[model samples]
Structures are given as C-alpha cells and as structure tokens.
Target: MPYVLLAAAIAAEVGGTTAMKYSEGFSRLWPSIATVIGYVLAFALLAQVLKSMSVGTAYAIWAGVGTASIAVIGMLFMGEAAGVARISGIALVIIGVVLLNLGGSH
Candidate 1:
C-alpha cells in the first residue's frame, strides 16, 4: 500500500540522517556510503507513494515526520539535549502534520 511505502520512505530518510551524524563530513567510508544509499532508497519509495497520494499531503507527512524522528533520535541515541523546547517542537511538528492531513481530505 501507499502508506506502507510512505513509512519505508520516512524510515530511510531518518536512517540517512542518523548516518549523516556518523559520516564525519563525508570523510568516513562506510557511513558516507550508507547515507547516500539511505537517501536513494528513501526518494525511490517516496516516488512510489506519490503515485496514489497527494503531493501536499504526502510531502508534509514525510518532511514533518522525518524531522521529528531525527530530533528524537538525536536526543535518545546521539547524546543530544532533550530539553523542553525541543520536545515541544517535536509535538508541534506532529500536530502540524496531522492538521495537514486533515485539511487535505477536504
């Protein structure tokens, strides 16, 4: 289903971003290759999702979710700060994505 593809795309995007943190400005070999591969697969799956989903809706979800996911990943696993402001920001992003989907249905 398109939703499944969207989820995969989001996961790939998140993975790519996480790998980017370890890429050391692309100087590292394996992480750099992983980043490129992750993004390639993400875009490919996202393209498939677009076949049935509206661009505004799909892209909003993809970007919003990916951003929020990366933020959380940073806090939880990457030793980034998990301050209140950052948590609030992620909540806002999720709400915005939900609102976008709701509006797009009309």
Candidate 2:
C-alpha cells in the first residue's frame, strides 16, 4: 500500500539523518554508507508514494514528519537540548502536517 511505502520512506529518511550525525564528516565507513542507502530508499519510496498522492500533500508529509522525527531523535539520543521553544516547534510541525493533509484530502 502507499501508506506503507510512505511510512517506510519516513523511516529510511530518519535513519539516514540519524546516521549522518554519526558519520563524522565521512570519516566513518558504516554510517556514511548507511546515510547514502537510507536516503536512496527514502527517495525511491517517496517516488512510489507520488503515484497515488498529490505532490504537495506527499511532500509536506514527508518533510514535516522527517524533520520532526529527527528532532526527537536528537533530543532523546543525541543529547541535544530540549527546550520549550524547540518542543513547541516540533508540535507546530505536526499540526502543520495535519492541517495540510486535511486540506489536501478535499
């Protein structure tokens, strides 16, 4: 299903981003390889998702969800500061994605 593909795409994207932090400017081998592979999978899956969904809707969801997930990963695993402003920003991203989907469905 397209939804499944989209979810996969999101996961790959998140994985890719997370790996990027570990990549250390390409000095590491595995993480850099993972980054390339993850991004490839994400884009490939996203292309498939486009077959059924509008570009605007799909892209908004992809970018919004991917960004939000990365931010959470940073806060939880990467020891990034989790201030109220950053949390609120992530919440706004979710809200914006929801609103975009709602409007796009029509």
Root-mean-square deviation per candidate: 1.3, 1.1
Candidate 1 wrongly placed segments (more than 4 Å): 104-106
Per-candidate count of clashing residue pairs (backbone under 3 Å)? 0, 0
lDDT string, candidate 1, 1-106, tens digits? 8889999999999999889989999999999999999999999999999989998889889999999999999899989999999999999999999898778622
Pairs that collide, model 2? none
The count of residue-pair clashes in candidate 1 stands at: 0
Instruction: Report the Cα lDDT for residue 17, model 1.
Output: 88
Q: After best superposition, candidate 1 residue 100: deviation in angstroms?
A: 2.3
- Candidate 2 versus the native: TM-score? 0.95
